[model samples]
Target: MSTDTNAIGLHTSTATQLAEHLNILLANYQTFYMNARGYHWNVKGNQFFELHVKFEETYTDLLTKVDEIAERILTLGHEPMHAYSDYARVATIKEDTHVSDGTTCVKGLLAGYKSLIELQREILSVASDADDEGTASLVGDYIREQEKTVWMLSAYLG
Candidate 1:
């Protein structure tokens, strides 16, 4: 590791920035996952079966991403934020409620993905500048996956 960076080969300041952004991403994923769970539990209509399964899958993926992000922060030699209060303060995505309607749930998901993608792009730029390939690659993968999800959800809403 370089003198300017931590043991993990990331610049100390850059690691700090990455950890902060990752925490924000984690918060958003948590909120999105919870919303999906709510949607899965409460959604009612002719499209119930399809949407229910879809929401379950979506939340499961989000849960996995949440863990990955927190672990990434640890790899960067920083502590991951855990409290809901901290999440609320740092997260751009707001917690949604009572969205039982399938269309409304899908729209909410699209909006959340919009916020998440923008943040991830910002992180990607920072990671690139810092030569943090791990963070850059992680954010890149998320962007690709989420862009496809956005496209699908948009088509669903259409």
Candidate 2:
């Protein structure tokens, strides 16, 4: 290993930086996941059943992402932020206020996904620079997956 590199072959400072970005992502995902769950249970409209199922599927996926992100943080030799207060503090995505309306919930989900994809893109660039293939690959996949979801959800709204 190089003098500056960590056990995983990534530069130690870059690993720490990536961990910070991942922690921010983890917090946002946690809050967004909860908002999706709320949307799942409370959504109402002619499209109620379809949206409810969609929100459930969304939250379930977000929950899994949350776990994966935290694990990635640990892999970088850092601790994941666990408290709701910390999540609220660092997350750029706000809690969903228009919960019960299908249109509003979908809008909120899209906005949240936009924030996530933006952050993940930043991390992907940093990870690529550091030669941290694990982090790069993780965020790269998420960006691809979310970009598709964004297009599909926008079509749903139209």
lDDT of each: 0.90, 0.93
Per-prediction TM-score, please? 0.96, 0.96
- Give per-residue CA lDDT, model 2, range 81-158, as digits (tens): 999999999999888865798999999999999999999999999999988899999999999999999999999989
| Tens-digit per-residue lDDT, 1-158, candidate 1 | 57889988877988998888888888888877888889889999988999999989999998999999999999999888888888888888888887888899889889988999999999999999999999999999999999999999999888
Predicted structure 1, TM vs. truth = 0.96
Winning candidate number (lDDT): 2
State the RMSD for candidate 1.
Answer: 1.0
Cα lDDT of candidate 2 equals 0.93
Query: Residue 132 lDDT in model 1?
Result: 93
Lowest-lDDT window of 10 residues in candidate 1? 1-10
